[model samples]
Target chain A: MIEQFFPNVNWDTMFEATYETVYMTAISVAITAVLGILLGLLLFLTSKGNIWENRGVYAITSVLVNIFRSIPFIILIVLLIPFTRFLLDTIRGANAALPALIIGAAPFYARMVEIALREIDKGVIEAARSMGASMTTIIFKVLLAESKPALVSGITVTAIALVGYTAMAGVIGAGGLGNLAFLDGFQRSRDDVTLAATIIILLIVFVIQFIGDFFTNRLDKR
Target chain B: MITISNAKKLFKTKNGSLTAVDDVSLTIKEGEIFGVIGYSGAGKSTLIRMLNGLELPTSGTVDVNGKVISGISSGELRKARQKISMIFQHFNLLWSRTVRENISFPLEIAGVRKNTREKKVEELIKLVGLDGRGDAYPSQLSGGQKQRVGIARALANDPEVLLCDEATSALDPQTTDSILELLVDINKRLGLTIVLITHEMHVIRKICHRVAVMEEGRVVELGNVLDIFKQPKEPITKRFVQQVTEPEETKETIEHLLNDYEDGLVVKLAFVGESAEQPLITTLIRSFNINVNILQGKISHTQNGAYGTLFLHLRGDVPEVKQAVEYLEKASVGVEVITND
Candidate 1:
């Protein structure tokens, strides 16, 4: 009865693929959070009227972020094959997929992080400065702390996007749910396997969103 | 003590150079509540910000408690700022921080120990009258409560001088009074010198010992609060004084009273200092043969003394009214006859 409808879905392989997908998403999201925050802080601090306002640094960073963020993810993976091979000696597994996954998603998340930082009240920063808070203190305690909820929600969105990017990375020989679905499901006409993988992917996305919303709501006092 | 000598602040804008503060020089005494009153863009904000080195004067020097705020190095200035704190018009508490945490922020910046910081935060919470709301977030507090937290934060470092930049502007009148009372209490208790800037005359009249009236990047008039209230020299100063001394409808009420009574002479009498406490109205009725009808009156108390204005209708013989006016003049009361044009 369980295997009645076009029985080609292997539970063990499906579980393995799900684990691979989760592993890729988790690692990339962690690294992306750090890199994105640094880039975002740079963009924000060097912009006009901020503490470290510098036109030259801001313009250079802005151009770099824009160039990376504007490229399509699939094209980016193809374009970064040489860099990925040089960095990791191989370009075919979950680890190989990480460089492209982080590079593709971090700038996207960096823009979100910048928007979150901008939402903080300028007066809060001034009040900190009036207390003689050093720049490091302002950045960590005031700017980042005040914008925590926005930053969490921004990273949540970025995390979900990275999950999707991981699947896209799986298309180019990076093993994950996408690789299993394409090679063993679509190629072999096993509709049930593809349906199973889709279900698992949707479940993963829903769980990430639920966790993100919980933390965001808990952090937001305003 | 603070001394601002030949201080000037200039800004380069799209339209060219704008002088935010011109050659403004003032000496504020220790442990005194000094106030700077001005309308928007009158440079009072720039002037006060200069005292704490928040805004650097393009030309001159601001010396606060023996440290030259304008010429100090950034490292020294940061150290100076811990002793010379400022609070803003908007109660700028960090929304994410609780009242205790917000108040604890300055102490943290000053590198206070964790145990000392916690104890100081509790004491400050009590000082600002926020005893039990320490654990509540700023979002949960009212405007008045937020300001209490702001004041607590400013006081956390035991600042020698507290600069209030339109601190009560955003509060309602009742809240403004409560906050002003708190500031006065802090000033008296801690012997902290306060430099506050506001556009409201009521704030100055209530707490300020000395007041400076600013207009167009300069101090138009400066003197004791009571003296300024008694004889406002500039038109701007007079307008500010009138804010508390005269109600908005006084002119229309006088006109209406003039139309209703065609026989009496309506006169405005100003009482200042010790004279306001005397029973001059009772004396006038007993000594003269006239019917006195009180029209409108207001008395404002300053740090130095009480100042008031009273409008009266004297319906009697013209000679008796003339005698009454002379009598008021002899009693050191300011008298002006209100006549129909």
Candidate 2:
């Protein structure tokens, strides 16, 4: 009965596809976290009424982030092919899929990070400054530490969005569950393979959401 | 220890330029608790912020211990701020940190060693009366407890001067008193110069050695607390003084007193310092043979001495009442005849 419900579903290929998906999502999310946080901090510090506010830096960065965020993930993958080939020496497979996945998701994540940082109390920053804390100290000890829960939630949202983008990366011969569903299931009219892929993606998203909720609840002091 | 000369801060808003602090020059002596009292938007906050270089003045100089704070390098201003710690009205504590970590922040900023930081934080925890609550976060504590953490953190670097920016306005009456008492104790023990800004005159009366009444970015009146309370020069100052000294709601009580006792002379006598303890009424009745009926009276004490106001209904002839008024005036007691029938 199970074979009847999931016809021609190769278990070994499914496992390889699932591993590729997790690997691509994990690496892309990690890279986006570091780069997006830096970009977000730059945006926040250079915004008007902030301590390190600068109009020129803020305007340029703001426009770049907006331009990147407005591009759809599928088109972003196609558009970043040349840059991906330049960086990775090829524009196929999971490794080549990385640049597009990270670039497509990082700007979106940076906006979320900016919003999270903005939620921190201005008084807390002032208090840190009044204590003679250096700019580095204030950034790490006050701004980042104070807004940890919000930042964690933002990361979770960005990670889930990356899952969708990684699935889209399968369009250009990137090997993941999405590739399995697109090449073998959708093109060959195998509904069982497509159903299995959908189930696995939902499971991954659920796990990410659960972990995000757990940390947010545990870390929130306010 | 601190001097502000012609310090002004002009903020350019969307409408136009708004003067937050204007040509305010004042000196705060060492080991004295000075207060700046003003209503909201009177620039008292901006004035106190300039002392610590948190808000730099537009054109003038702010000198703390002979260091020119305004327009100095950021690093130099930060170093100067370490010697001049500040506590805020909202406490401004790091919500994510425990009480101990919050107090240890400045010590950490100064790069004190781990063991030394622990010992100092322990001592400060006890000093602020937090005791076993050091492991608690700010969200778990009451308003008073959060302010105690603020106080302990401000004292972490053993600052020579403490700037309190509306430190007790957010607290209730009882909490405000406890915090005021703590400030007084800290002032005495460390001889730390505290410059506090508040809209409450009672706060000024409780601990401030000297006060400057600010209005519309200007120090309208400035004097010792005792002198300011006893003889308020400005109209706004008199209203503030009346809040503390005249407890029975000054205007309505006087109206009621005048309504009831319209036959005899209703004299309002103000007493300050030693005059508050004098037996002027007894001497007048004994010597002048006039009957005295006390109407309404309230006496309050400031840091300096006793200050009070009393309404007396003297049933006597015109000449005798005139003589009693003259006697009070000669004795340095302020006499104001409210209603003379």
Could you tell me the fnat of model 2?
Answer: 0.78
Mind giving the per-residue lDDT tens digits that candidate 2 earns over A1-222? Answer: 878889789878988999999999999999999889999999999999998899999999999999999998888888888898899899989999999888887888888888988998898898889888999999999988988998899999999988888888997889899999999889999989999888999999999999999999999999
Q: What is the lDDT of residue B265 in candidate 2?
A: 78
Cα deviation in Å at residue B126, candidate 2? 0.6
Pairs of residues clashing in candidate 1: none
Candidate 1 CAPRI level: high
Question: Every prediction's TM-score for the first chain?
Answer: 0.98, 0.98
Lowest lDDT 10-residue stretch of candidate 1 chain A: A1-10
Count clashing residue pairs in model 2: 0
**Docking band of candidate 2:** high
What are the per-residue Cα lDDT tens digits for candidate 1 across A1-222?
648863988888889999999999999999999999999999999999899999999999999999999999999999999999999999999999999999998899889888899988888888888889999999999989998999999999998998899888989988889888888889999988888888889999999999999999999899
What DockQ does candidate 1 have relative to the true complex?
0.83
> Runs in model 2 with CA error above 4 Å?
A1-4, B339-341
Candidate 2 pairs with clashing backbones: none
